[model samples]
Target chain A: MELQKKIEILSAAAKYDVSCSSSGSSRKNKPGGVGNGHLSGICHSWSEDGRCISLLKILLTNDCIYNCAYCVNRSTNDIPRTALTPDEVADLTINFYRRNYIEGLFLSSAVYKTPDYTMELILGVIKKLREEYRFNGYIHVKAIPGADMKLISAAGAYADRMSVNIELPSSQGLRLLAPQKNKESIIKPMGLIRSGIQAKREERKLFRGAGSFVPAGQSTQLIVGATPDHDLNILKLSEGLYHRFNLKRVYYSAYVPVTTGPNLPAIVKPPLLREHRLYQADWLLRFYGFKADELLNDAHSDFDTELDPKSDWALRNLHLFPVEINRVDYSLLLRIPGVGVRSAQKIVAARRIGPLSYDNLKKMGIVLKRARYFITCQGKYYGEKSMNEHIVRYGLISGKPEIQDSTPQWEQISIFPLLPQLPPPEVRLATLTGEL
Target chain B: MIYLYDGSFEGLLTAIFEAYYRKENPEKILRNKALQQTLFEEYIHIPTDEIKADKVYDSIRSKISHQALQHAYYTYLSDFEDAGTWIYRYLQLGWKMGHKVDYHLADDRVLTVHNTSRKVFGESHLLLGLVRFKKLSSDLFYAPIEPAHNIVSLIAPHFSSRLADQNWIIHDVKRNMAALYNKVEWVITELDANPNLTVDEEEQAYQGLWKQYFESIAIRSRVNPDLQKRHMPRRYWKYLTEKQML
Candidate 1:
């Protein structure tokens, strides 16, 4: 087949797998290389739905023997399947990278005849991209389920990152939905990748590069709301995976229910917002120092759609909040509803100068609307008298600040506050206080 | 005391010398003594006095590097800061370095001015996308941007006849700054405030479509209001078509 036709089939097949972030890796351009990696996020383009569409993100081939029900490219689906030669794939990546259109490549494939056969093809592409083409750019490869361990190791050395999609949260779900896949095929390879990363880190104690195997580590995706798995169960699985494998990311795809078979539930629409809520929880776990059990339990199977996960956590654990901002620990400060990493850092920087009041928090860009109830800035309360769950939930949903803006200032709602003219210290206090 | 001079770079250069000599603050400068109707205060026209200006420039060069003096001059020319003449104080620190430590311009004061320089640099970048140029009948180009800062001078090089041989004008509606380029040379001006612009009507439609596409593509699943606020601030929304004017 012509290379263009092959590219179309493979790339279209790979579009469903949406875990394309080139941020974590910090590889620079070396001599005799075509591209560079950026710590600052860069994606070549975006899909119509504002999804990242950069990095010639394509399956090396869609020809698979596995019949996973959730996947469109499952074997029984009888979709048009094709595989690309390593030469064909490398040429396309080089061309795309040169045009400044794509920073790298994200290559995956369905099991083509055998898991070993598919992984070998993937490794060949990376080998050529590095050895022959001399391309020093970011490349993320999939660790196919049941793939041979040696081939997995070979692919890791050449790629900037490697990912193995845990795909199903539960072993029971995997069996019912994807019969061809099993627990051992997936988890064993993840263990292999984890050990490989650890070994590289240990070796780097003395030897410098020695090929940093998967500098971005491994990331997995979980399909939410597909089977009978609860949010707590899924989050538990994610927590275990993070601890077990040291995963850089765990992407939650709102399962697009595409089947009506007797075994499958009749899913009308995907739980997109649920996926978003999970992502919010995931951010809390990684950045905000939150544990999975803290946010969800057996009684609450779903995350609160009305409020974000962090806000929901704050409402439930009311005792923890109103923590003195001046005296609170870093980890506790991170749990405040509106305080993000940047705000936390700014608070640390600002407090070195003076004891911050409730007014000073907003100037540091804290979400005073939500955080005011949670943080005690030098013994001042900007929140309401009633901290009732329903009242707070209602406030979150209705877009009203729990504390009313009693002191109305012009710059608070102005189109352009004079940037050059510094607001008076009192106005700065009002800007800092969420109430005004 | 008030120090008014012929609005030249050197005239302001000399005024910086007198402001320090008199120890007058910015509030005193803006509240001109004669204009203030206060009997004890006085105003002075420093004039296009090359001797004083050259003396001030020479002393600055002797103390600070040429780069620091240039930055101070640009900051003075910008007229953004409350005290445009306070740059001389910074220049005094810069002159002691002369060359070596002048590049260590990342300190608090140097950073304050450098950061403002970046803000002006960013305004130029944003106006690149916001300024819609239209091809006029005589094969000239014209674009108008309503920027909050006087940033036309920074973006002049970007369009300088990339359509060369074609006359063009970039009118800044907010600060009333315009860059009139006639194929080769460019001149900056502050014309009378004219909100009535003559932008090509078709360019408006393309802009509408461009904005529509930008808005349509943002996924509702991840509509992070907090993140959005942290980025595109509410203040700059007036100039950007992506925002809805409430």
Candidate 2:
């Protein structure tokens, strides 16, 4: 088949695996080489689905031996099948790197013939790119499940990062949707890659010339909203992966239903917002020092669609509100609804000069609308209403209209001894305080 | 008094140097091309002096911090209308407060300089990926970009190290300059708006496959053009090979 047609088919099959980051690897170009890794990866473009196109994400082939119900390339599905030769893959990667169209290659494949055979094809393409073409850019390849350990290790020597998709959160979901695939097959390779990365690190510490193995580490993807798995379960599983396997990232793909089966859930659209919320919660877990159980529990298995995970946590833990901005610890400042990591850091830095006022916080680009409800500046409250949970929640939900013009609509004249009585004071007070 | 100088980074630094030694506070510091003379104001044309510029540069590095010097340089590259005046004001404060001037986030002068520097650095970082090179008929890879900031010189070192074996030219079409890399070194020189160039026969085939891959990789169910535009803005679409269809 023609190269364009083959790429269209294979890239479409590979789009479901959404681990697009090309970061954490810092390889320099050889004297006569063609490419180098950007320490913090650069995104080349954004696809129409709003995902960053960091790498040339494509599969070696779409010919699958296992029929996963949620996948587009299931064995029962009628689709054109083709594979790229190692020569073609290398040629494409070199030309694309020269054109500056991608950071590197993200090579994945279906179980063509067998796991070991598919992995060998992948290893061949990467080996050709790294050794023959002298490509030093990022290469994120998949560690084919149930593939031979030696073959996986050999592939790791050439790949900067590797992944084995968990696919479903639970083993029951795996058995129900993908009968041939098991959870053990997925986790075994993750364990192998983790040890491989660890062993390489120890070796490099002793010998400066020791070659790196998977310097960017490993990542995995879980198909969200496919099986009847709760967000809590997914978060717990991800926490375990991060702690046990030392994974670099856990990507949550909002299960885009491509194939219908008895096991898969009938969904019209991908759960994008849910996936976004999971990412927000994931960020809190990774950087904000929040635990999975802290964000979700058995009582609340799903996130509040109306608010973000951080804001939801703040509203539930309202006894901690109105924390003194001048005296609060840095960790407590991070727990505030609107204070992100950058804003929290800025607050800590700016406060070292002097005690900050609300105006100073505003100048530092903190989102005052949500933060004002939970913070006090210099022993003075600037929130619109009192610290009642219902009132605060209502204020958060129905954001206050920004006062663009500083001029008051109603003139306050000193000549009049009484208060300005042109409007209904009770109704205005009720609306502002969320009490009638 | 208004201080006017040739529109170069060195000229801006020379103006700062002259202001310090002369003990006269200028009302506005501007580039020669951006001057708008008022009826009552006295204008002083400060010639570009490399020696004075280097002195101020070294003082900024030694007295203040290397990071502060970078901020000053990046702020100059921003080419904002008030970038010169803001840099002057920022340095005036930096001289008094040392490196702590950058931490004064509430101060408008420091904030403006920091924000402008961030913008300049951000654009250069983005161009590291957005630059699309086409293999010429002569085997020289050429790319044309019209960036919002003067960033051709900033992004050249990156490509020089990455594509060390290949000769390439990154043309800043808006600024009418190019970074010419000859596999060993790179130099920024003036180039015409349009250069006579031809792509190789196989370049179109590779671009066609790239465009196909770009389209195929987007999930049809979750296509959000607004988010795509937010990340890769519409202004940058003209140079992007995959965005040509849109």
Candidate 3:
């Protein structure tokens, strides 16, 4: 096959994975190095399709031995499959980097023969770039499940960020659809990477002057709607990983069905809106001083589809707000609807110099349209003074989805299962009517 | 009053000092300096008076915190329309308040000056991300930008430390000036205009590969032009290689 044709295939196969930022690594340029990771400011390259394009995102190979039902590269799917030599990937990366096309590489793969073989190809590609090409750019390597730890560690030495996706949230989902893979095969590598990243970080701190390392840290992806895991479960799992493993990011990709398999949930629709809401909830947890349980508790294990996580949380706890603008701390202000990170910071900064009023907040960049409903200016509420959570929720999600679409088939799947237990269908069935 | 001088920052400070020294109100001062362009335009040929500029700087330094003066200076260096005089006016207002000015956005002049400082910082941030480097023959590096606000003063230190080893030139074509770095010294130069450098064959090939990679990474399942435009505005599209209208 022509090299360009091969590139097209591999690149297409890699698009499902996302790179949310351009702050590729914390790695700085050394004596003779050519590239350095950007500090402070993150520059992300996004495609017209709204996906991040920082990584020279591609797969090592799409040819797989196992038949994972949800994957397009499943064994039964007669799709054209090919693998690239490590040199080819290195060449593309260096060439692209020189052109200022991308900041780094995000390389993933399906098991071509075995997980180890696939990982070896990926490791070889990165090694070639670091050694033969002398390319000191960011490399986000995907650790294949069941790959040997020794090999995974070798891959780590060359990569700036590594991810071993917990492909399906529940292990039982993995058993039925992806029979060849199990929970341990995925989770073990993640645990190893967390330890490895921590060890390297500690080593660098002691060294004081280590120039290059995985400065950007590690991240993983969760395919929403594929398994019936509730939003609470997802957020709780994310919280556990964040606190325990110290992950950099967790990407939530709405599942897109590309193959037909009996074991896979027959999802003919994609839940794009729900995926967007989940991301919003994830943002609240990460930046808004919100815990996963705070957003999703026993009363609500699933997110309210009608309202955003913050608004829902606010409505549930109405007693906290109508906060006096000049006095509210930055975190409390951030929890208010429509206030962004930038706005929150601006409020804190501006208030330090003066007693801020409602008018002043507008001038400082508060989105009063959303926030007015939740907040007050010196105890004067512009929003409806009603205290009901349902009223607030109905007022919000009642509006159309922001990035609206007749969501594609893949986005709307859902489920739950313990390691070997399938996800319950009732959780995601309100909109789906028990597709199971 | 034609506030002309050696064209140094100190000279500008001297000009501002003269504007107040001659007891001329700002409007009257400008009208007195009007010249060949219009009959109403006056001319006050201010000389290179170092003493006058020093006294003005000394007064500003003593009255406010050094950080405030530095922001005023950065605002002055921004060279935006009426930016220097506004900073001059605002600082005077700040000094007049004695202590109340520190805790008030009550003054419109204060708000305007603060806005200018933030505007310059904002541009510098965009350029921090937007500046693209092209390696030239003999390892000379170059980048071109047409920023909405003058942010060169703010971002020069970042470029110096980030690209510490390379001798590079960043040309802000819109403003008709450039910052060039030698082995250790960074200096600014004014040009009548720039020679729009042509893309070399190697760069073109690299761009082709970049475009491919950029196009490939986006998943078609969620193609939202509105969202893409929100993150990256259409105004910046012409300069970005991937977002160029195909």
Candidate maximizing lDDT: 2
Ranking by DockQ: 2, 3, 1
Tens-digit lDDT track for model 2 on B81-162?
7788899998999999887876788788888888899999999998898999999999899999999999999999999999
Q: How big is the positional error of residue A374 in model 1, measured in Å on the Cα after superposition?
A: 1.9
lDDT of 2 by residue, A145-245 (tens): 99999999999999999999998999999889888999888989999999999999999999988998999999999889999999999999999999999
Work out how many backbone clashes candidate 3 has. 31
Of candidate 2 chain A, the 10-residue stretch with the lowest lDDT total is: A398-407
Once all C-alphas are superposed, what RMSD does model 2 give against the true structure?
A: 9.8
Candidate 1 backbone collisions, by pair? A322-A374, A359-A432, B63-B95, B64-B94, B64-B95, B161-B164
* Tens digit per residue, CA lDDT, model 3, A1-436: 7666777778888877764465646666555444556654345455777654566778888888888778877788877888888887887776555434567777889888888888888888888888777666678888898999988988888888888787677777778777888888888888888888778778888897644435567788888888887888888888887887788888887888776666666776667777888889878878888898788887788877767788878887888867777788888989888888977877776677767788887765567766776766776876554745655555565542233244575754455433466447675674477555
Error of 1 at B143 (Å): 20
Docking class of 1: incorrect
Candidates in order have lDDT scores of 0.70, 0.90, 0.71
- Predictions ranked by TM-score, top down? 2, 3, 1
Top-TM-score candidate index = 2
For A1-436, candidate 1 gives per-residue lDDT tens digits of: 7654566567666765668787677765555455666664464334435565346677877877877888878777866778878887887676444323456889999888889989998998899998898887789999988888999999999888889888789999998988888888889999999999999999998888676899888899998877888888888888888898999889998776555555566776678888889888888888888889999988886788888999988889887767888888888888888788977876775676568876556544467777877777787766667667766666666657445554556545665564577778888898789657
lDDT per residue for candidate 1 within B105-222, as digits (tens), equals 3244554555455566565555543454554545555666666566788767744523333577888777677898886689898865664455544445434433343344344444
Task: Give the CAPRI rating of model 3.
Answer: acceptable
